[model samples]
Target: MMAIFQPFFNIISETGRVVQFFFQMLDVWKRKSISRDLMFEQIWKVTVQSSATTALAGFFVGAIMTVQFTMEMKDFGALGYLGGLSTSGTIREVGPLLIAFMLAGKVGAFTSAELGTMRVTEQIDAIRCLGADPIQELVLPRFIAIVISSFFLLGLGLLLSIFGGMLLGKYFSGVNYEEYLRHIPTIVSLPSILSGLFKCFVFAVVLAVICTHRGYSTTGGAKGVGRSVVQTAVSTMVAIVIADWATSLLADIALKIFLRSR
Candidate 1:
């Protein structure tokens, strides 16, 4: 009877260990002297490496939206509003969300796999043996990098998407470039842009921290590393969706309160 329960007990013990490891990671911020080089490396890898994919996706999304909306507008004789509608929708929602999703698959997975490999190869252990803090060296820099990178990527994605939409509108929908540009400013609100930026920043931080933590905790060599990579991507994406909703709700409430006060 005791033998049967031993495996279950061991499973519970492992689960407890993982939970403890997560809390320990939360304490990483207390350390001073973050690694600037590592942060830059992370930014380059997460942001620059991801740029092409995000840009391509943004272009297609913008082009398709323009086409679809133009068709609808044609039916309603409101084709002139296509530029403003497409720009507003893309910048405010589609652009940021798409870029974040791409980063979760690309940067998030890469970060997890890189750290997971280090863990399996005992590189992280070597750092620990040298009396260096893994959290400060490994996690903090990547966290900051991803947060900054996300903002830049989101902004770039917005620009590319808007460009794609404008070009498509001009060529296919008979809308001129100047007319498209003229309406964009009116449609793009400061609050909406700020909200998107804020969301991207939060998304990036969550991705980096969670993925790094997952990799840092890997144990069983190659298999563990692989598992960490998959888990990191999945978890980061789920977190992004949840965070987006929460941010939107909070922003809406705050806006309402501010308007009432005004």
Candidate 2:
């Protein structure tokens, strides 16, 4: 039915727009389509304002995983192994995932709603009429900000997660001091860090495309803007999960190739 296919076509059309926007950004990367001031301001907003939430989410995720699993591991008399396992698990999976969810709920929704409101207000069109590429003026800076922010946030989350696992191993898990310390900072590896950052970058791109596309598709008015926010959150999360698994496989392959090359 047309109704079933309508969403599919819209998604495809949006995909095209995202590609076009990406290419346009690439073309203008040197000239810097947008002003430095605007880009930095947006970057600051994404990175700094989001830090508290990121820290809390990352810490709690690590703590909860450690608490939940430490008990299970203890039943098997394997408590000694929990610290490293928990910390590594957090870095390899939890950090990027929670960060993606947080970004979807907070930043992605905000970007969609903001852009949708602008579209409703004809601001985007006005910018176009004034001889500015909306993609460059609006989308490029956001794309740059989010990708950079996600990478930094991924690292931050990893650190906080390790820190949280440390606290739990010491206080909640009944693990010994040397064991706890050794558990955490020990599993740090280049591949895990690189994979996490790479996934974060892909998520950043997914969020940007979903939010901006939904914003541009806004039609009805205030109602449309609200719809876009919801759509952006849902779409971004779905895209992130898919990308997460896919990138993990790609990372494995790439790591293998790198190892062979070396």
Candidate 3:
């Protein structure tokens, strides 16, 4: 009985810790204790590191989606709609989710390891001993940077995915660029675009919080840092998937309500 309940207790305890840490960061932000230079440096570093990879992943996602849609539509003589259908699917669901996963694996893991190292090496403790708040001097900048960079990178990926789908549609299905892009406006609405961006924002926050929390709590030295990285990856991925489902459901409901009102 105790063993079965242990996992549930662990989940609750972890959730509490994450929430507490998030509020601490929030309090720092509220007090304007964040260092602009540190925040900007982190933002630039992460953005530069992840840009190419994120763009490549986004482009391929669109291309693969186009290919799948093309195959399905070709059987029905509907290849002309490939661009719109694929673009709609990618932008609304696949693009943000998969791009976010890529960001988690790269950005999340690196941040966790870096923080974990500092924690185990007693750098964080040294800062505290010297009368500096590590949260303000360290974690806060990273937290803000990850949120900003992740948002921009995810959006960039979504943009590239459109071009990707168009290029692939033109070559693979013999669909002209104009025809391929023609139905996008008809299929992908403003609300859908907003929903995707919202999901990106939510995923970014989730990724930032998990990585920082895991890193800050790391205890066992090198092995502990490794464990934290693994935990960050697994937890962030699971959280993102849950967030994606919840956002999709809410977006659909909101759209329905809006349509009824109009």
Ranking by lDDT: 3, 2, 1
Give per-residue CA lDDT, model 3, range 173-235, as digits (tens): 889989988998898888888888888788888889999999988999999999999999999
Best by TM-score: 3
Which regions of candidate 3 are displaced past 4 Å?
none
Ranking by TM-score: 3, 2, 1
Better of 1 and 3 by TM-score: 3
Runs of candidate 2 exceeding 4 Å displacement = 1-10, 30-32, 75-78, 257-262
What TM-scores do the predictions have? 0.87, 0.87, 0.95
The lDDT, on a scale of 0 to 1, for candidate 1 is 0.80
Report how far off residue 255 is in candidate 2 (Å): 3.9
Q: Lowest-scoring 10 consecutive residues by lDDT in candidate 1?
A: 14-23
Best by lDDT: 3
Given candidate 2, what's the lDDT at residue 132? 87
